[model samples]
Each structure stands twice: as structure tokens, then as C-alpha cells.
Target: MKKIFKLSLPMLVIISNVSVGISQVNVDDRQSVENAKIVGQLHGLEGDTLTLSYWVNALGLDETSSYKRAFAPVEQKIIVAKDGSFSVRIPVYKKLQYFSLKSNRQKTIWKEEYFFRKGKMDDISTSASVPVLNWSYFILEPGDDIKVVLQHGQMSFSGTGAEKIKYLNEFKYSQNRPKSFQSFRGDSLSTIKRISYYDDLQQFGINILKKYHGRISPMAYQVLQADIIGHCQYYRYSSASLFNSYKDPTIRRIYLNIYKEQVKAKALPLLEQLSTEVLGLSKSYPLFWQQRFKVEQSYLLYNAHGDGVETQQASKNDLFEAVLNLKKGLLKDKLIVMNCSDMLKVFGQVQVEERLATALTELQDPTMYAVVKRFRDDFSKGQLTYDFTMEDVEGNHVRLSDFRGKVVFVDIWFTGCGGCVSVAKAMRDKVEPHFEGKDDVVFLSISIDKDKRMWKNSITKDAKRDPKLSYQRPGAHYSGDKTIYLRTLNGSDDPFIKKYVTNAYPTLMLIDREGKVFAFSAQRPDGGKAKLLIDQINDVRKL
Candidate 1:
């Protein structure tokens, strides 16, 4: 499943701690050593490294870049000894937290292959080593010491909580079998095929969990079950978007009937199992919690549309109203916390403050209210945005603060992003003409590409204009003086890129005349939001 909540787990590869002798606990970790420990032995893995990571926040509401800084995952790496033995102590949590292990040898084929529009070849066109994580997950909590044994990538467990961990691993291995579904053609057949694929996938996962029912703790089993259901439900919800593009009357009617009969019918019973009382289990699987809310909200909206309800009490996508449909408990309160970002993005500050005020009145549990309040106060309009300095094409140092008195439109992107190129085309063709000679505004494009030669070549023209290379890319279109483009000093390793711009590319931000943020996520210059972006620029200038 595509990850909806981009957990800001640090992927920054730490230098191998080869010298940090195994089983050595620091004085400060004496208490944690008593509480939590993992002792493991490995074979055929003496040269590789192992990384252990676990979430600090259980509810997965750490959505913003700032929140992630405060509650990032606690990750530690240990290099295997020649004897194939290693030991490490990790921080403990009160709840049954989900912990995962990954190896330095693990990697995915590069996602940037053939990013150039034309199927082309070059030193850069071949696959690069990207760290796409495939984690082996297990449950960990306070007062647990587990010993693990691994031989040639096969792992077994013993000591406290061994059965639970063993069962979790077994379930993971079962689900890793190769599966495929019909490719999306944005038609009725594609939609039906997707729904059937997820249905079978969810059932397959549930059967695996059932096989180990008594062997695993009830809490662990419940969480795993919710995860299986949530994953399938999230896909069902995402598939609803297909109706937006292909709106044939006859096809849509048949699609809605199949959806109501099969999709909705299957999801309701599964969703019921994830009630408010089980909110504590949510922390161990934050993605499950996040997907649960999305699934619930989509169910309500689609139900209303299917019934042909002309008059609704609330707006179509109003999450607050959807939350009200749930029982009064911690689940309701936490979902409200998760909805704060969506409100801020869609309705802006005034509505967010008003909603939070109203939410406070109804909140039965305030554990996450602080997060909502902090997000509201910190990202409020007019906050001075982070200042960055980088080298332009001429190697001249330029700082964001230098353009303090101008309205700055910032685009954060990298070499292989297609959306960035499309947005650049839209900006060049549509938005730039209006601000052609405006001195009060600036267009800044920052790239996270690592190779300076590749960066330079991308921005400059191919003298040959090989018809094969005639495709319009962000670098080519953004190369001109009309746009001031700069590349990050160390590519993805740059601190600014790591800390602020996590994951999403083609991110657009609007900075006001005082170098304060007007919009953290501004609209793209596409057909739908181009006029609004133009108006936003004009409006920010007036301030």
C-alpha cells in the first residue's frame, strides 16, 4: 500500500559504529537496559549493519515537519561482529509499540530510471541504489528482553515475548508472496479488478493472523487485524477518485452498485472491530489509525452520494461532521487532532481556530489537544520562514533574506520529478506572463540533485537538440533568467532539505514581502489553481 502518513523516520545512514563494542550500556541507559534489550546472534552477516527503529508517538498524529522534529523515531545501528553476535538496548515505551529491523544490505532499484521524457541512455540513466526500506516488524514494550537468532537472513526468536515476535515474523513472511492485479486504465473494469484485488489481499492477511491466533497476545492480534482491514479500506477509499475522471452515466451507475454491494458491505463489519475502546492499540500502528479516519470519512461521503441526497447538513468533505458520527471517546478526540492539518490546509487559520475552539468544548480526552494547539500557533500566517543560502548557476552565493522585500514564490524539486516539470511549464506559459516585469516578485527554483555536472547540464541546453532530447524538462524550462534556479550543495544530504522539505517534491511556498510565510503549501500554477495563485501573489504584495 502507498504510505499516506509519511512518518519522518530518519533515513540518514549513520556511519557504521564498528568500534562501539557490543552489549555495552552507557551510564545514562542503565534504567532503560533494565527495561528493554535485544540480544541477537547472526550468521553470514558479519560485514553488514542492523538498524532498529520504533515510533515515539503512538497515535501517528505527528504529521507536520515541526512535530516530526520533536517526536522522530528512536533509531540505533549496530555492526555485526566477526562472531556474528550483537546486542543493543533501545528506549522503552509503556504501550505495545511496533519495532522494525532493517539491514544496510537492503535496497531497492532506483526510481529515477528513464525519468527523461524520451527513453534515453547515459551514465545517469542506469539504476541507482536507493534505500527503500523493507522492515521485519515485531512488538516491543517496557520490561521485555528478547534474544534473536539469524542464519542467512532467516530469523528465529527466544526469551521473553518470543512467541509474539515469532508469530509476527511468520505472518510477515506469509504476506510477502508475490501478488498482482490488473493495471489501472481508469475504466470500470480496472475499478472492479482493484476492488477484488484488495478484498483477496485483506482476506489473505487475516488468514495468516488467524493461524497464530492463540500464540500471539490478544492486543497484538487486534492491532494486526486492524492493520489488515485498514490497508484494504484505504485502497477502497482511494479508488473512489476514479469516479472523478471517468463520469459516464451508464458506467458510473453500474460501478456504484458494485461498490455499494461489495466494497461498502465488506468494509462496515471490519471497521466496527476498530472501536473507540481500542484506541490504546492505535499507537503501535499509527498508519492504521491514520487510514482508519480516512476510510471512515470517505465512507460517509460516498454513502451520501450513492443515496442521491440532495440536501446535506454539512459540507461534502467536512471532517468535523464525520468525526461527530463516531462514538464519544478517545478515538473521536484523536481523529480531531489528526484533522487539524487538513483543516489548516483547506480552510485556513480563521476556520481552524474556530474549529479547534469548538473541538475543545466537546473533547473528552485532551491528550492530543496540545498538538493541535501547537500546530495552530506555530504555522499561523506571517511567521518568519526559514532562511536558506545556496549557490546559483554562476556559483554566486544567494540568500532568501536578500529578497526580503519581494514576494517570493519558492519551488522545491529534484531532477527526476515529472510533476515539477509540468508545474514549471504552467508557470512559464500562464503565470509568468502576468508578472513579466514585476520587480516586487521573484521566482526561485531549488533542486536537490547531487551531481553538480548533472545539475549544470540539466539547466543548460543540449547544443544538438537531438530530437530525442527535445522534451521540455524543469531544468530546461527553468534554466532561463526568467527563473532564478539554484541547486542544493550536497543534494539530499543538505540539512535544509532533510529538516524542512521531507519527502514531497514540487512543493511550492509563498513568502511575503517581510520574508514571512504566507502559505506553507501554495497552489500550483495548473489550470485549476493558476488564477488563485496569481491573486495570492497580488494579495501578498499588498501586505
Candidate 2:
């Protein structure tokens, strides 16, 4: 039986608004070594090339956008000249930073399922492409100097903090597409239309900051009101599993009694503005305080497993008593170093050093205890793995520890992936005919395709497979059928696809036989898990 409730337990006791109207912009840690000047102009592209990144450190907003595949530790390319000017100065890592300038040949190569779709924008900039003539977020400071131009594709700005992001390049891109929510339409009409679709997107971003009040800059108007309440509480706790596939307890107590008689008293003051004093001005406040601490730790494990609430399972001492029922400062020390960087990426590093010894005195921010002790000295389990180098399809290169004593099974795909062609048609029908002739098993596959002719037309095709041109043709002769193709030699910026794909993909690893890592998310020969990926490659070839 499923009828689950706790749609984030009635917006969990309206967040104690730490007197909104956000603050924190004092600067001085030697103003991150001061510099900031960015003159611009690029009328007709001329000698091309442009880039101007930022985000030198917002500790990757305590990760969770499929662990944000690392990049942008400050970039800067530019080139342009032939009469269409350009200038650069950068360095201000503190007071009101955020930048982006684009057009390094309108680049676009990224896929962690496009960060949950629908025009994803934090003033645009994801695995690129969202700048019909760029310059996103753009709010500089230390020793200010601004001034930009662009022309045909229209973009402008002028001297010293030009009216703070000139209404973000003239706003109205249909207000970053909000207002969605309809799926499970019963549990109180999908819980009062998903709390009035995030209170009409926090009153349409406070009526566009009261129609551009004081022309925007009090910390870019609280980072656009914490990017409209962190995209309405990150799409309301990532659409809290819309009533976990409904189990009809009389149509869920008849629309949870019409959401406690017509939407629980005007939706608890629009879910008390999901406050935590919009912490240190927006990179959307730690992804809206890690989606409001995973919706109050899933309403404290659905009130501690009340009647088989989907087979309860939230350990690590139930995530340290649901973050010791939070209250302490700096957003509970940045959600205790983003709960030890999501418990060292799913319970590893000996369970985040045994919950950092009871989370080391509730970790009082020394930059969140040195960012969870640098994610516990960069977590490692079975270790070894990263001998990277890939490129096959004639350009040769290969290397993952030169398949040392085999047992590989890598996968990691791209180039129009329909779930990597349904796990390469379940590894060509039920796991390569059960490892027929396994010389210590291999399989491989890689890709992260940065267009080596679309990764050699998606692994050198075979024929007769057009489920509507299977995501740009893919039938999988992944290297003459049995699978062994490669390609990531710097494709998705390969540092072995950013240290084992945290910008996800069809990523499935395994390794063993001394090449180490026995599964950084393995098992996926599609639906009928191909005899559980052939019994986890025969239990990692019997270790």
C-alpha cells in the first residue's frame, strides 16, 4: 500500500525568516586580492574567441546537481580585436562577483540529463549554451570598471556597476519558466496545486523586485530574491515524489481534505520564504539550503517509519538525527558540509570518517571544516581506477590501466543517449551472451563524445535500428559488437570525465581485477538487469 503523505509536512513549520532583505556584502579578506575590470565590445565577431568565467569558489555550492562536474575555477579567453575592442582584469573573489561572458564559439557539450530540464538557468551557464549573445549573471565589484556592448544579438552595460546588471540584460525571458506542477492530481489536488505552484513563484519574484526597485543592486537584489526562492524550493523539493505513485487510501483522504480546507491558510506565508538569511548572497543560497535539507530530511524519515512508509532506510544515524534538528548558524555550518558532501558520495570514506566523529562539534565553519575535510581527503574506496586515456575508432589510445588482468565493464556514454541505447540493448541482448569466451571479461565503451564525428557516428553503426533514428543512430556495435570502443580523451573535459562522471551519463563502472574500483555505480544492462549485469560480472570475477 502506498498512500504517502508528508508532502514536506505542511511546508515544515514555516521557516523562521531570519529577517529577509538579505545582507552580507562587506568584503575584506583582502578583498580576494582586488582587480575587477572588464571592458568589452564584439560587434561582428572579427577574430572570434571569447570566454570570461567566474565562480572562483562557492565550494561548488555544496554540490548536488548530479555532483556538479567541476570546471570554472576562473576562465578567461577573449581574443576579438579587429576594431571590436576587449579588456580583462578579474581577481575579485569576494563582494558581489558572479560573471559569465560566453561565445567561445557558442560551445555546448554537457549532459547530466541536462540538469533536470526546462530552461535551467541560474542566470544561464550550465554545460553551456543559453546566450543568444551572452553575458550572464555579470555583477562585478572590487575596484569596479565594467562596460560591455555586443551589437546584433544585443547586450549592453556601462561603467562602474552599471545599474547593477541592467535589469539582468532587460529581464523578461518569460521569467525563467516557472509555474508547473500537475502530475499526481489527487492527494489534495496534487497538494493544492503544489502549494500554488510555489506561491505563484514567490509572487512572481516579488513582482520583479517591485518592478525594478532602486534599479536592482542590494546584492543584486538579494541575488534576485535568492533566485526566486531558489527556484521555488528547488521545484518544491524536487517534486517530492508526487505522492509516491499513489496508493489510493480513499483518494488520499479526499485531497488531504482539500489541502486542510482550501490550501492550509494561504500556504504558510508562502512557505515562510524558505529562509536561512539567503546565506552569503546567492549561488542560490547553497542550492536553497540543499533543497531545504532534503525537505526536512524527508519529514524526518516520514515520522520515523510510520507504517511501512516505503520501507524506511535513512541511516548514518538517520543522517545524524536529521542534522541534529538544525538551528545553529551559517546555515547549520553549511548543512554540515553538505552532510559531509552527501556522506562522501553515498556512504564511503568509512561513512564520512564515522560521521566526522559526531560531526566534529557540529562543525563550526572553518570554511565548513575545510570543506568536509576536503571531502575526507577526496574519498576513495577500492581506489586504483583512474588510468584514463581513451580514443579508439582508429585514432587509437586506450589505456584504462591497460585493462590490467581484466574484468572492466566501464560504459560512460554520450552523443545522444537514450539511456545509452537502453544499456546498449542490454549489452546486445542479455549481457553479451553471458560472457561467451570471457578472456577475463572487458566490455568498456566510454565516449563522453566531443564530436569525433559525433563519436564516430555513435560507435560505428551496424544497421536496421531506427526507433525514430535511435538518438542519432545507435544500435551498438560498440567496437564490433561485443563492446570495447573508447573516446573520452578530453571530451567532456576528461579528467577521466571529471573524475568519474559527476555530470552523470550512462555512467556505470566496475573495474576490479586489480584495476580497482569495483563499482562506482555499476549494474545496468537495462530493465531485466541482464541477470543483474551478469551477476555483477560474476561477482567481480570472484574478486
Model 1 — TM-score against the truth?
Answer: 0.74
How high is the CA lDDT of each candidate model? 0.59, 0.58
- In terms of lDDT, the best-performing candidate is 1
Q: Model 1: runs farther than 4 Å from truth?
A: 1-34, 58-72, 107-137, 175-182, 246-255, 267-271, 283-316, 324-330, 352-370, 394-397, 414-419, 449-480, 489-505
Query: What lDDT would candidate 2 get against the real structure?
Result: 0.58
lDDT (Cα, tens digit) per residue for candidate 2, span 1-543? 221111111010111212110011111243235777777787877666666555533423222344443222345466778887877776665556666666655635332211122322122333746434466555666777778787886667888777666655554344363534443433444555565567676676567566777765565666666666665656555444233335554543453344335433334343345455445446555555565454445445545654346521343446556665777655566556556545443443355566765565676434444444434443455777778777787988879888799888888788777777788777877888778788899888888767676566567665444443434664453533677788876777677766666445677777888988776667676767689779978988997
Least lDDT summed over 10 consecutive residues: which range in candidate 2? 6-15
TM values, all candidates: 0.74, 0.30
Model 1 agreement with the true structure over 306-350: per-residue lDDT tens digits: 534321223335557767676777567556655654555445445
